[model samples]
Target: MRPMLNIAIRIIRNIGNIIIKNYEIQNINSDYNEYNINLFTKKINKNLNNMITKVIYNIYTKNITFLCKKKFFIFKYKKTIWIINPLDGVMNFFKKLPHFSISIAICIKGKTEISLVYDPLKNDLFTAIRGQNAQLNGYKLRCDKYFQKKNLLFALNTSYIFFTKKKNVNLINLFVENLISLRISGSISLDLAYLAANKIDCYLNNNVQNFNYLLAGELIIKESGGLITDFIGNCNYKNSTNILAGNADIIKLVISKIK
Candidate 1:
């Protein structure tokens, strides 16, 4: 990475910290109400989004290539492409619930070479480099959660089985019977963030398309003591049509049961 790129990333990280703290303080003052809290949260998101856009424009005008989800822009040069998610859990933040996040990744030829997932709610940041250990807030994180599995708390996205041509009712029933509990949180980004914090044990949702899944899945979970793969146990990020994420043992057990 070039020195300028590193400096830009550092600036982005700093701005994220400030925004998270500001939102948290705002929520505290709003008594956790939707009306007032959401307005402030939207303002914060817009501010961050604008800053990111400026950075992207600067990089692009200089002939850099990039990819983005909405306005979370990433600049690419040569074989490297950056993936960014400016606001992960917009609804949660809007409702004064503390679970949203910011995710960024540097992919070299479609493989993540460097990545950062930051949850402003808990002030948790997970960072990783290819072929090296992942870290959570600078502390080494490992995907070992044997004890968490016995009483699993899972998170998933809600969608119809219409696309699958298979009824999910029976599968849902089976999973409910084995798992301790399940939650349908509106945001996949927050779901991964919660998993990293141990607020949730695992996350699985087969209906997710490549668009959203590619951003948050590995940025947070894989970097914070968790694993991610398709339902059939394939680790390829883009090939994962059906996703499963959790601590190693928890993910393995869930995959076995679901398959």
Candidate 2:
């Protein structure tokens, strides 16, 4: 396959088409010029998050693979894979419900290195580097801890957990009780990006794709002054059945409870 990145671009184009065809077409918001690019050579950074699915990309490889998630596209690259969930909340968008997005990231050598998540409906993008800052559109972003709710928003993949053995139910409920609010967004990539943006306090994944598929947001949270690790508190992001990510304080507390 051409490589994950290339597939991501094609997927973005497809999503953009869907959005423009579905909603009123408009010009690109003049918010961030430095973050604008429709090519793969463009600098990959946090600011690229907003234009999540309108980009046309090429990943320098032979053969290409594409997969669609509800209304998104995922691709495969050489020694890497690109997964893009375009239109994360399609149901909400079709119903004029609320926030929806397009998420794209690349996993290289089993680690997340590049990510570009955009909300096509809002034309907002969030980009990130492995060890650098994350940006919203073009402005640097840091996950703020000003949330005062005693039960800060907690996100989980409940649908995926329903099939789990009953033995894990206690652990699930224990985690649930710690948060002030809980949500089940159907998009995993968006869930992690939301954490980087401080929209949510913590997120846990029970059974997701390979670790490489998660590195982009994993590194984003770390770069944005957050924390990430498996159930055992190990920082390894390469191979794990589950992951806990959030701000440093939240991750520590959540990890302590899991132990």
Candidate 3:
């Protein structure tokens, strides 16, 4: 419970509360289109970015990059960068699904130090420091190892189908045929959080975007004793990079299958 982390959690929770409140005010119908969704998302994103920028400046006095709705606002001062994603699952939110979250991470020289992902719908907060254990609502978390395919619960994003290669599709098919169950949650941050909490055995996404999960979710998984890497077991997970995450044994088995 460091001072900075405490401040960050408070700010994130407040922003989430605001977003949820505003979301409830909208008369969302099943007829909502992408334009309607984008309008609501932009409103929330702008408010969150502005509020977070002001609050973070008062505490860290460092550089900040707010990535919301694919827009970036950069500020300069110290070397530390606060990577903020105001909302993680805009599509789910539009569909009136309660799977989205707010992700924030403090990175220095491309290395994440403090990470936080808050789900306002569930009032669940997942957090971690660089070398400390990951936590969900202050309870420690750890990834569960599943060596047997029949016992594994794999999580993914259906959006992968839109961005994946043919090889990736084949790999996904292999997983679907082997794993006990598969879930597409529409929220990478929440998916990674569940992976760290052992709610899911593994998480695979070949179409990961930087603003989606790279900043906060990656560090949360690593801190929780989970492994994350590219499809080839390399640690180079940049924007648009493929991702495979799980425990050591599970990661090895997945790599072997995909290869």
**Model 3 C-alpha lDDT per residue in residues 72-114, reported as the tens digit of each score:** 3333346666666767777777667778988888776767788
Show model 3 residue runs off by greater than 4 Å: 60-76, 160-166, 169-173, 176-179
RMSD values, in order shown: 4.7, 10.0, 2.8
Q: Lowest-lDDT window of 10 residues in candidate 1?
A: 162-171
Error of 3 at 32 (Å): 1.3
Which one is best on lDDT? 3
- Overlapping backbone residue pairs in candidate 1 total 1
TM-score winner between candidates 1 and 2: 1
Model 2: lDDT equals 0.61
Give the number of the best model, judged by TM-score.
Answer: 3
Deviation from native of the Cα of residue 223 in model 1, angstroms: 5.4
| Model 2: residue 56 alpha-carbon error in angstroms | 6.1
> At residue 238, what lDDT does model 3 achieve?
64
The sequence of per-residue lDDT tens digits that candidate 1 reaches over residues 61-104 is: 76675454454566777776766776666666556676667777
Better of 2 and 3 by TM-score: 3
lDDT of 2 by residue, 3-88 (tens): 44345545555555565455443233333232332221122212233344234233343455555443334555566666655455
After superposing all C-alphas onto the true structure, candidate 2 shows an RMSD in angstroms of 10.0
Q: Rank the candidates by TM-score, best first.
A: 3, 1, 2
